[model samples]
Target: MGTPVLFIHGLWLHASSWEPWVTRFQDEGYDAQAVGWPGDHDTVEESRRDPEAIADHGIDDVVEHVAGVIRGLPELPILVGHSFGGMIAQRLLGQDCARAAIAIDAAQIKGVLPLPLSALRATLPVFKNPANKHRAVSLTAEQFRFAFGNAVSEEESDQLFERWTIPAPGRPLFEAAAANFNPHSPAKVNTANQARGPLLLIASGKDHTVPETVTRATLKQYRHSEAVTDLETFPDRGHSLTIDSGWAEVADTCLKWLRGQSL
Candidate 1:
């Protein structure tokens, strides 16, 4: 057995989307697997066929679900998460559930103040309707293109959408949008935990869903901690950097950083 590495996908993407990264990490001698959210199905088709199962699951639900999986592992795993999954990874790491965490384009936590207009547009599908808060909402191909594939070609974006996109719960987004105003927001992460494991923050320069400013804001939240906190940026990449043809580069970067950390 080797040090476990867990991959967490954000909304609109299936767990299987991390398969390539899993293989890459496994080839490098790490035990890697992508775990879905609490109500997610084992397969994309099954999840798409049954949207109710994935609806209404909030940030707390995902955190507890992944935390349970980590608790059952033989050793504390390294969490590598995308978007909202990134937020979940940080939350779990703060609780001392993992050895380290890599949060890529993580959603805005409670203390982050920047709100780029592009981010607002990317998530408009859910915010346009208050009722969506308790339902499963999916993005149109065009919307997916704008939010996740803007850095890639239209053809590649459509292909990725067809292969991995799925309906996502609107609760987490709602929770995050209202975090600053809520006292006990689920979007909050304990970034000041000096005793926690190393944390890595990855950002895409052209990400409309989570702008670089937002990721930068996320890093500042940990200013109170003296632990190993690092930031990496892929200036030419977009939110789909993890699932597109260029994923190997990002995965390799992650592997290199982990080895450097002696994980």
Candidate 2:
């Protein structure tokens, strides 16, 4: 059997956001599972109504959540995550909990420079509101389109905005923004750990939330994994690369990369 693959979704998204990728992986003979963050709702609408429930979820909580899922598997799984999930994947790898990891359009690690204008704009709304620091906030359709669905057709974008967009916890974002300077922050990942397994950092060239420059800067953290680190860039994709129209291509690329690894 192929190695197990565990998928982690980004902020404002549920495990169901990975439906297409999960199906694709399973068809290719891999055992796949999409685990939710603690207190994450099952649906977008449900989450929207109770955004506060997810507000306090921090990086440590997510790390423990994904780690628990990994422990349930008989073999070490390939951890795949996007945005916040990608951050958690990095932390998991640092702890030596996974056989392989793929971080797509992930957030910046400590010490990365050159934050992009697009990323700053995308985050302004959340950070501007002091209340958001301790609360969850749901984006409007327009906000969703700009942040996650800009690359898709209007119809598809609208459908995705309606179907997948939800309220997201704000604490993690606040914490991540201050991660580099805060020694007590849990959002910080030890990406320089040499013992961590193989890692693939996928950068979406057109991603407004995580610009290519920032992604490249983030690579420095993995310098210790020189022999095992691989970077791939998808020029036409956005932050929602895994759910966009060409999601299969991205998933296939990751599957192929994992196949070449020892795990």
Which numbered prediction scores highest in TM-score against the true structure?
Answer: 1
lDDT per residue (tens digit) for residues 1-263 in model 2: 67788999888787898999888999988899898887788776677777777887877888898888898889988899999888888888888898889999888876776777888888876888978887877777777777777777768878787777777888888888888788877877777787778899999888888887877887876776654888999998888788877888899899889879855
TM agreement with the true structure for every prediction: 0.99, 0.95
Highest lDDT model number: 1
Q: Candidate 2: minimum summed lDDT over ten consecutive residues — where?
A: 218-227
Error of 1 at 58 (Å): 0.2
In order, what lDDT does every prediction score?
Answer: 0.95, 0.83
